[model samples]
Each structure stands twice: as structure tokens, then as C-alpha cells.
Target: MLLVPAAHAQGPAPALPTAKPRPPAPAQPAADPAYEAARAAFEALPEAQRRAIQDSLVWTGDYNAVTAGTFGRRTYEGIVGWQRRQGVEPTGILTVRDRPALDAAGEAVRKSLRFTVQADPASGAVIGVPEKLLARKSPLPRGTRWQSTDGRVTLDTTSSPPGGTDLDALFERATAVTPERKVTYKVRKPDFLVVTGETPTGRFYIRHAAGADGIRGFTMSYDKTLTAEVDRLVIAVANSFSPFPNAAPAPEATPSATLSPGGARPGAGAPAPFAPPPLPGSVARPVATGLALGNGRVLTAAAALETCPSPLIGGAPARLTLRDPTGALALLEGGQHAQGAQPPAIRVEAPASGEALVVLGAEAKGAAVAPGTAGAGSVFAPLQPGAGGAPVLDRSGRLVGLVARFPATPRLIAGVMPPTSHALVPAGTIAAFLAQAGVAPGELAPAHPQGASLGAAAAPVLGSVVAISCGR
Candidate 1:
């Protein structure tokens, strides 16, 4: 699990496609009645048949025709030739009788790519995939992932974040791709967003929609040379795509390595009086901030768990519990004593964009608090390293969010670029995470406008926050 902002970040899978959506166009002038009618009738045909018609026209030497489902001047001229070839009078329009023959001809062209329908029970995404080309498939964080053996094609399905994702955020991620010669097309309706473009790597298509079930969509990419055939295959996948209840079993809990009175040992029932081994080189053992909830439950950033074999809170060993695979939240158990006295009364409250807030676990002298502001899904605090799991509080000391590092655009200083800044997981995300874990938070109300000094406001909550350390 990763702790980056779920609203903007793609799911946990490393190879999944990211999208940057484009702006919607303004309303256009009304079209001629006759042209509009013909366009509508053309669009009414199956997308496959329309594309097939377009390809047939191109194959028959109508090089100016684009396969898009529209009946423009070039397309009309191409249809005339097709009509003449079918022994019908050249009306420059296709009729019901001509649809089948067009499809049959299109099918003949697509036969070179043997396609098969594959059902992903885990994510409930059933799509027509080119089994002959892509022989490897795997399950991803929120969907299924597939790739061709030769690495030419890739496909993925994605699920929306917990509190729902803003369409603008989704659009921004999709359009970030770059190439010297790039072309993009975007469509935004009341319910869904589609972004497709050609980058240096390949032709990419991304679709995102928020329905009653949640935000769900798919992405596909192929070598530029495979555009025509790949277009047909993806159309079939889109038409058949659907989601059902996720039926995969939950993963078993990971055992926390326990420390003995003598020394350190792996798991339970082990002899003591030995030093613990170092954590694997792959995982980073960074110091992080942690928040104390009641009943030995502590909440922190998921990034902190990436390599910590045994995570420590206030010098006491803590147990790993539930974590959100799609966002930056993790729930821990058995560390209430680390907070000193009773766990501080923590409450959830949403803060305004520029609300006066203090970050508790930030590296500061004495009772000092690092000042910051609330962003869309995170906080904008210039926190020191190791503040990943700190608590964010309002002037009155109510919990507003958890401090976590999130992806930010890089900035250049002198001649080199610096890393993105850290942010807080907003209260809305905290609420959704705890709700899923069946933990009810205490009543929290917005604080009154305040004028207290930073130290005075932060002192009360500082005692309840602790720095987390990790080891093998």
C-alpha cells in the first residue's frame, strides 16, 4: 500500500496507466437539420460496423476517409464507391441491407488478430482481449492487469477512490503524458470522461465513470502500427465491460515480530537474547509520525509500513492491522500506552482551504508547531523528514488530518530539481478509512476563529503524538 493522495494518484500497481484529462469544449453552433439527422443515423449503427465501414472505404482507395463514426463529405464520397461496388444505385448512404456485408468485410480484415473473451472474477471486468497476443494476466489493486508476451500491448481496469474522485483531478492525471508529436481527444459528459491520445510510446485510451457502484474504468495501449486492429479489439472490450461484487478472499494478517525480554526474535514462541536482523535493502526504514486512537489502535501513513519488519511507537512494539491498498491510511493496534496517560481525545473536522492549523509531529524545537493549510486531499505543510504519520489539528486542537508525503510537481532550484512537498490526508479520507474498519470516531466540531500563539495551540496535542521507528 502507498500513502500518496488517492484522489490524484493512480492505484498501487506500478504499471497502471495515468491520465491527464483535457478541458471540455464550449457549446458549438447548431448544425444544419439534414446533416444532424444523417449524423445521428450514422451514429446509431454499432460502433464496430461504423469503424468497419470506415476501414473498408480506406481499403478501397478512399484514403481521405477517417474511421470516426461521422458522415462528412469525404465519408459520403467513400460510401458512394462502396454502394457502386455492391451493385446498388449510388445514393451516398448505407441502408439496413448493406450493414451485414460491411461487417462481414470488416471481420475478414480483423481475422489476423485472434481475439478471445476473458472474465476477471476478482474485479468483475469482462472484456474481449487478444489472447494470442497477450498471454500473461494478473490481478491489480482495484482491477485486473494484462500484458502481451512481447510487451507491445497492455490493458487495465481501475476503481475510484473511497470518497469519490473529482473529474478534473482524473483529467489532469491522464493528460500529463508527453511526446514531441502528440495528439489528444477528450470527451466529458454528465456521467463519464474519456481521454485518448497518441504518445511516442503508443496509442493510449482511458475511460473513467462514476456510477452507483463507484468510479470504474479501463485503459488500453498498443504499438502504433496495430492501431486499426487494436481499435476493433478495444471496442469489443468496452461494449462488454461490467463490474460485479468483488469475490476475492481477504489476505491473511501478517505476523509482527515480537521482542523478548532477553532480546529480539521472529514472530511468537521464539528464544530471545539476540539482536534483530537488519530490514531488507529494498524497503526504507524512515522515522514517521503516528496518531493514537483508542483501544490500542493507532492510525498512520501506509508508506511507513513498506519495509518496517517491526514498527515501533514511542519505543514500544506495535501490531500491524488493516490498511487501505488504494490510499495513504493504515490502522494499527496495541499502542495506546505510547501516547502517555489516556490517548488524547481525537476528533475529525474538515478544515477550510487556508484555515489556521498546526502540524504536531513536525520536527520543531520545544512545543513549536509547523504552520500549514488544508488542500483538496492533503495538507500543504513544509514538514521535516520522518513526519509521515503525524496528526494535523485545528487551532482548538481537534484532529483534522494525518500528515503524509504526496506526489507534487517538482521544482528547480539553481540547476537541479527538488522533491515534492508533504501533505496531510484530509479528514474526509480519515473518516472513510475508519468507517471501513468499523471504528467510530468521537464527536468533533469546527473550532472558533482563534488568535492563540502557535506554541500555545499545539502544546495540548503534542503529548499525544509520537514518532514511529522501524527495524527488522
Candidate 2:
């Protein structure tokens, strides 16, 4: 049975209108003392502070309020809304007492963004970092390097040359970090040098200093999609970058700072180990969402695949293969444990802007659905960390896209950056990829079988969704 178009879906028809429009309410009296005092306190804040407050509100999804330092009705309403969320009275005013809560909220955001200072006493390297974004800091031949767990961000500092190398040599070594990178910026001076470029996978920025102290510098490589935060991070990292007093290069290490043919530092290209810290009470932990494609195949996020050599889908072991970086998607083959698996078929058509869509995946307990609206190029949905690589389906249960998690652009939400959000890769991209690999994806589930409701049509597909993992 075919499902009726949403425009004509059956429902109770409304009776003829009989009531007249109500009159507008009378204007309220002057602002209360509390509100007035709050406004004064807010107005006293410096421009930057006001902007920070505005940014915090924006992170809470206040598209109506402007970040300008001026206090207005919109900003007041936003503050009231936020206060209500905090279980506080909607006073529409920020009291000095609110400072603690506000700061705590900001700190939470910072923690979410993984913003923390990394100080290596041994390497004499101290730098600011997004801790949540990076893992496994290790001593490099010259200094130290920290790679993002997902392989999207990298930061490394090279040892100081007791007397910095000449500008020419520094320039050569810096540019060679990523040979194929497209140089976006270059500067050469007698004592300082910098080079920036973009690679197929991401972008890299290199800074070198030469003087009596020798060459002490660091490079930042990150995913291009995070350009906004990248700029700010670059600035922050550089400003905070310093070597402790008497900091000197470690004894002769690796002779060269050159990268391996793979464009990663030695022993740094591979993903980290798959052993996630045991959950509280020694329980197991789910790694990522996996889309069961049937016929002994499943799909999951590329990041999850990176660290797991032997991943499990629905308690069935699977082998990882096929990775698309541009699409941020991964495919796994072999999952014989799941019974009655039925993967949704690809729609082969893009969703219209503002169209309602459903994102399916298994997060923690079992399968879940995240409702989303189609955006210009992707579907915007509220997503959790592990929902990457889930199938995105239209109202009729046709596969329109795949979910991907990308590092959100860095912005001060409170004190930290926003958590990564999910976006849907259109079906055409997936189809083209499958075509290139000579593998056909799952077929679209039959729509409205037995006059089933949308929820019913979605159940089987969700049943095929699994929480993937890598554990002993």
C-alpha cells in the first residue's frame, strides 16, 4: 500500500471557524527594579564581555539575538530563556550572583570543546590544546606531537636549534612538512618564518623561529571544515606557545624532521588503540553507530573504524574496509550474528529544503530516530557523538543520506566550543562511491507495506541498526 503524500494525509478536519480574532494585550508597565538593575549590570560589561554573553546565548540557539554589545529586548529574552533552562526564575536580568552559574556553564562548554593547556616539562613545550579533540601526546624526534583521535587535527613542535637555522633552511623544512599541500601563506624573514597550506585531507600551518635560542616552533594541522576555529586556535596556540626557562632541545633524537611518505609523522599515522576506558562498574561501552547493510556487511563512522581492528556490529564481528574521507563515511563487511537484518535502500534523490527526514541509528540501548530538516546541502539534525554513519531516511523510509560527525567550528559558547553536530551526505554521493567500488548498497525498503504508518515503516530499518564496538 502506498502512503499518502503528507500534504493530503488523513486527519480530522476542523469545523468552520466561528470565533473572532482576540484583541492585543495591553502594554506592560515600566521595568521592575530587579530587571532595571540587571540591565544596568549587563550594560556595564565591556564590549568583549557582552559579546561573550551574546555568543553563549547563540550557542543555546538564539538566532534572533545579535552579538552586539548593546542590551535590547532580544538579548534580555535570551537571558531569560537561558535562566529558565537553569531552573532559575526568568528574571530577565543577570545578577552578580549569576556569575558562578554562568561561568560554570561556560566551563562546561570549554570542556566539551577539549580546550586545555598541554605542558610538557620534559620537552619544554607548553601549548594550549583542545584536549577532547586530541589524544596520546608523544615525544617526537625533536619535540612533541599530539594527534586528534580522529586523525583530523595534529600539533607538533620541533626542537630548538641552539642557534636557529637560517631563514632559507627553515623555510625549506617547513614547506616540506606536507609536500603536496597547497601553500596558502608564506613569509620569510631573517629570524622568523611561517608557511601555511592545505592538503587533500586537511590543512597545515608551520611557524619557525631562529635566534640565539635556536629554532623553536610548532605546526598545526587540522580539518579544513573547521576553518573558523582553526583561525582562532592558530592564534591562541601561537600566543600561548612557549618554552619554559632553560628549555633546550633534547639530546640527539631522530636526525630529520621529515614526514613519512604517508604525510604523517613516524608511528603517528595509525589510529590509537581500540581499548576505550572501561565504563563505570566495569560495564561495556558502545563505540559508534553501525548501519547493517545485510549480506554480512555494516557501515560505521570512519573515526570508529580507525582505532578498532576488529569491530563488532550487533555483537557480530565485522572487518573494516572502504573509507571515504570527503564523505566522512566508512563501511564494514561481515556481520553474520544479526538475524532478520533489512537495510534501507538508497533514494538516489536529494531531499528538498526544509523537508522532514528521519535519521536512524543505534546509540546506547537500541535503535533511535533523530528527526531532522533538510538544509540546502545536507539535513541538519541534533545528534550524539556515536551516531556517525547512520542511515538518513525520508518520510517514506527511503535512504537519502548517511550521517557524519565533523568537528564543529570553534566558537566560545560559554567557555568552550560546541559539540560536534551531525550532517547527512546526500544519496548521490553514496551511490557514486558504491559505483566506484563496484558494490551495490542495500535496497530501499518497500514504502507503507500493509498501509503501515511512518513509524512502522521505520522499525525494520532501525532493527538493522546496531551499536558498533571494539573490545576484547
Candidate 3:
């Protein structure tokens, strides 16, 4: 009888095909007829489908952060797609095949317009549980379905109903719910995700989901706070997680051995390389920031730009400019302003006071800009592809890197670049580089925002080795 120790959710497993979010042109008026119409159409959806969407809607917008219901917004498309999944077409220009669905969907959206607060009754705080959006299929052949629920849960594949419940707690109980077949989300191998923002409004789980390049999915960001408990269960799940009838032993890793003059100690002959042990949830927060700049320079870190260029061309100087999709000027800055110095593949420097940098963080709502201080200039979003295209920023909104490697490519997501090569170039080294390029001290004020946060600065993992039972 496992219990909900509290907590929930993970990055979306590879998302199924989704509607192409028609991003609205930037700098638009607060009210748009198209947006209102579409919204009305959605709010007016049928009660059942609307209920599913409500359950699925892990509201990510910050509380009180009023969003201009705009056309082509990613969130909008995602929401509309949810309606489509329920069999509705919602483009404003209603197609003949879409009118009936549109009329029905619009009515549902209208009737469904009501506040939904998934809360932790204990804290009275609104809560978000990860949508049972399949993180990925389990290795188990029987497959997974909701068994049953109450304060506790029970499971049997066919004998179940699909309904939304406290996903956080469900995830907690699912970790060790017995007689409940163990299920392994084999593909969700542990990886790093940076936690960008945490607030009373909500947390964000930002991740590069599956093969969907450049794009990321936003979850309620529950895992950020409940990580410790989540991870403990994740490990237990890994070991016991089995939908697989005949389990396969994880293949042996190439064992390592040091050439000690004599054969090493009793058990030291051939040992595995020191593997970076998994974090409880094998999850980490993203560096989400809102440091926006006028010139399209949304500040972030070199770590966030890890996917930009390979062997990552750092130290070598380069120039960058940020532009919004509308071709409106955002920010114009070079990677390096050195008069004659060749652009290093990477440049490390401290952001001058008042400059902007983005939080290339782990939370959802893939990266956003944050000003060094509030009310200063905000950071810009990554400029879409085009001329004078995009200029990435450091924490202080100075030029840093670019989005060279998009998710569109076949690259499997992995770790980021080392600190030295990233947007957060070291203050000490950056100071020198500035001078060498003839940049005067007074030109930019130095604000040494440590590129490292919560756990970035390397820390030791200390533990006492122990052996435990497989049946755990």
C-alpha cells in the first residue's frame, strides 16, 4: 500500500504531432478580434472535452500575468490542438469540414469559461499535476492505464476509467503502488534540466521534448519543488518498473581499471568509470529568465547556448543582432567589439551593470529574458531566423551566443557546454578581453552576476557505499 508523500510530473514524453502554433506578430495591440473569436470558440467547447482540457490545462502563466489573447501564440495552438484531439477544427477561417466542429468547439469553450484551481488542499495553494501526457511508453507490454483512484490508487489495465486526479500525488504513489505492475519509462533516462523560475503563481518545467527541435513544452513545474521525493521514487521505479514480462539486464558498461604496478585491491581489478550518479528525479531546473533588451537581445547563459555551435566556437570573436519576427529592430550587438581581433568561438565576460541576460534555465516555457533588475529593460525572446537574425545575451543582456543547433536537427538532447565557453563568460577573463578590444572601462559598468546558481558551482557528492536488495 504505497502512499502519496506528495509531489508530481516530468517533461513531456515526445509529444505527438501537434497543430502548428501560428505565432502572432510581435508588438501588437492588446485586443485583437481574431484572438477574441478563437478564444470564444474554445471557451465554448462541449462540457466533456472541455473538462478534459481543463484537467490537461496546467496553467503556466504567472498568476495575474495577463496575456493578450493573441493569434498564433504557441500556447493558443496547443490549447486549440487539445480541442482538435477531441475532434474540432478551430482556425478562425472556418473550413467547410470545420464549421460543425467549430460551432461545437466554440460553444464548449464558452460554456467552459470558468476558473479552475487544482490546489493542494493542505496548503490551499493552487496546484498543478503533470498531465498524463505520456512521458513515453513503458517497456511493459501490457501498457499503462489508470486503474482506480481515491485518497489512494489501485490499478488493472482494462478495468479503469480515465479521469484527472492529483497528478503530483499520483506520481508519488505510482512510484511504489504495489500489485500495481511496475512500469519503467525506459526512455526517460536521467538528464539535466535547469530550473529557471519559481513563484507563488506556479513553477515551470521547461524541456526540449523529444525530437521536437528548438521547441519545448511547459508543465506546471511541480517537479522543481518535489524533486527529492520524486527522485527517490524514480530510482525505485527504475529498479522495479516493469511492464516487461521477461526483463533484460541492463547491459554491462565497459569496466575501467587503473594500471596499478601490482594487481589492485581485491575488488578494484575492473571497475566501472565513476558514473555521475543520478539525481533523485534525474531532473534539474532550467535557467528561465525574463531579462529582455530593446535590441532583441534576450539575456541568457552560455550553458543555454550549448546547442548553438559544436566544438563550440568560443573565445573567437563574433557579432550578433536580435530581431523579432516582424523585422522590427530588437537589439544590435556584435559577439565581440574588438577592432581587429578575430572573433573567438567563445568570449567570456561579466555583464556590465544594466545589461541584460536570459535565464537559460530548466523550467518550462523554454528560455525567457530577465533584466538584471526589475523595471530596467526586459530581455527579448530568441529572434526567429532571418537577416541580422538573433543576438543571444548573457545574464546582463550583453551579446553571448546564438541558437546554432536547433532541435529540428536529429541531435539527441544531451548536456551543455562548460562554463568557460558559455554566455556567462568569467568576469576576470572578460575584463581583460574587453580592454584588449579597446573597450574602455567606463563604456560599460561591471556587474559581476555569478553565472552559477543553486548548484552550478561544482560541489562534491559524498556518500557511504551500501548494497541493497533487488526486491527492495
* Backbone collisions counted per model: 12, 9, 93
Please provide TM-scores, in order, for all candidate models, with all chains considered together.
0.36, 0.36, 0.25
Model 2 misplacement above 4 A? 1-283, 303-310, 315-317, 324-327, 406-421, 436-454
Per-residue C-alpha lDDT of model 2 across residues 1-472, encoded as one tens digit per residue: 0000011122343332232332343444565676676678787887778767765654443313224456655567778888888888888776677655775675576567687777665445566776666776887877887887777778887755453344445555554534666755443322344566778767777766543344556788888787655554564455445544343433321212221111112222111111111222222345677776545556665654444566765455665556654535666665453433555677887888977676665544455444456876676654444556777778677778777543322322212112224566668777766655455666545544433333444555766777776656
In the range 318-349, model 1's lDDT, one tens digit per residue, is 76666664557876654444323233335555
Q: Whose lDDT is higher: candidate 1's or candidate 2's? A: 2
Best by the lDDT measure: 2
Better of 1 and 3 by TM-score: 1
What digit string (tens of lDDT, one per residue) describes model 3 on residues 54-155?
223223110111111222233355455545555665444334454454445534432343222232222221222222321222222222222112211111
lDDT of each: 0.53, 0.55, 0.25
Report the lDDT of model 2 for residue 3: 2
Give me the displacement of residue 452 in model 3, in angstroms.
Answer: 6.6
Superposed model 1: Cα runs more than 4 Å off: 1-81, 84-89, 93-97, 109-119, 161-166, 177-183, 232-472
Each candidate: RMSD to true structure? 22.7, 23.5, 22.6
Name the runs in model 3 displaced over 4 angstroms.
1-121, 127-433, 440-452, 455-472
Model 3 clash number:
93
Error of 3 at 107 (Å): 10
Candidate 2 residue pairs in backbone clash: 106-415, 109-416, 110-416, 114-131, 114-132, 161-215, 164-214, 345-443, 345-444
